[model samples]
Target: MGHRFELHKDVELAATPEQVWEAIATGPGIDSWFMGRSEIEPGEGGRTRLTMAGHVEEATITAWEPGKRFADRTEPGPDGTFTAMEYLIEGRDQGGAVLRLVQSGVLGDNWETEYEAMKVGWDMYLGTLAAYLAHFPGRTAAPVSAFRPGAGGPDAVWAAVTRAFGLAGPVAEGQSVRLAVDGLPPIEGVVDLAGLPTYVGVRTADGLYRFLYSGAERGDALVLGHHLFADDQDPARAERAWQEWVTALPIG
Candidate 1:
């Protein structure tokens, strides 16, 4: 049986509606904040695609209104499962803009688990968006992604990750972190977002490093969705290095 669900979230950004529109409606813009590599075709009926780790998903644009609103819907699968997402942007008189997201979908047997995971995932992505607009507005970022399979539940996996980073306990926002991984130079940054087992984001001088727990069931227990704004960084190489780093972690 298929079950339907919808989620609503609103985020206020310290950016103009046009700026917010650019981030949501363009490929590079989306790449700066959201997961995976994304491509958007113009106008209503055009297509939107996201590619990650050799997996590709595409959706058709259902509504497009430039800086005002954008919406898309995925084709139904054989089990009658489909997903739709809508973003509404409204400028505030005092400045900035409010971006509202409405995501609705139909799921197969594991609806409850999938719904919970999606909820957590969206929260992390939206938080990243706000951070991007605040700290790296108008800058294009090269996206870096990596993932690792994991066992155990959320708490256990999260604990292992914290231990690998030498964190004593839960990650705290504003706390300092220094990374000296193999193949990469020393990285010094401060935590900007920390949401327990689900996500943690760090902001350095030129990057936003986001770590996500895509759920134990999904097999991608640890995911790195990073945005590097520095011109010297190569995304593909960074991704490979991070993948190696994640795989080598003592999380098992």
Candidate 2:
């Protein structure tokens, strides 16, 4: 099939190639930063499964080498096309590692919409990955999201989101921050993801915050998501707190 879309990104990780491999190759490791619950047999041709928010996704390991490289491709999507994904790891001569992601495939008839969404999603997930290594080193995360249509431009919507999260303002990737909302305890983390009025994120001691501006052409929408990294409890409380805060924001 003629591949119609591709997205590639490279991120510097404050980790070793082995540490990076742990998060990318193993199921439990991926669970720490990527999916809801993941199970992967890392040898070539092994099975890989990821369950997210009750939905399951499967893939086959196309390539694998411990502490080096890994790759997988999903089953054909609705468009009769499959997305081939790859992770290339290189240990820097100075120290640390560089992780690269290349996802390419056909995106069917709704290519533009799907492609854009995937780009944004990757930005959040990958940034979360780096941040996870920095703080919550060995914990897996569960996702919870809350979004609502808004009544204004991206700038205004983003402003409202910042105020709600107690963020001083827009931040740059890698900036350390501490959030102080009125009804909650202090939340602290680093800005692993940042893209102006489009997206921003902070990976905290126990989780991550991914804030977004969406559907502006139709009617703006503000989406706030949490990736909670804990083994004992459901993410319900965090989800409810965020949903209520968004509803009470002055943006819309």
Q: Candidate 1 on 141-214: residue-level lDDT in tens? A: 99999877664577777777666555776689988878766777677888898987788888888999998887
Each candidate structure's TM-score, on Cα atoms with residue i matched to residue i, is: 0.95, 0.78
Q: Highest lDDT: give the candidate number.
A: 1
Candidate 2 lDDT over residue span 1-252, tens digit each = 334787999999988898899999987577666635689986999988876545888889999988888998888876587788899999999988999999987777657767887887777778778887877765667676776776478877877666655567556776777766545567787777787767788776677788777655535777666677756546677667667777777873
For model 1, the local distance difference test gives 0.88
Clashes in model 2: which pairs? 32-140
User: Which has the greatest TM-score?
Assistant: 1
Model 1 spans with C-alpha error above 4 angstroms:
164-166
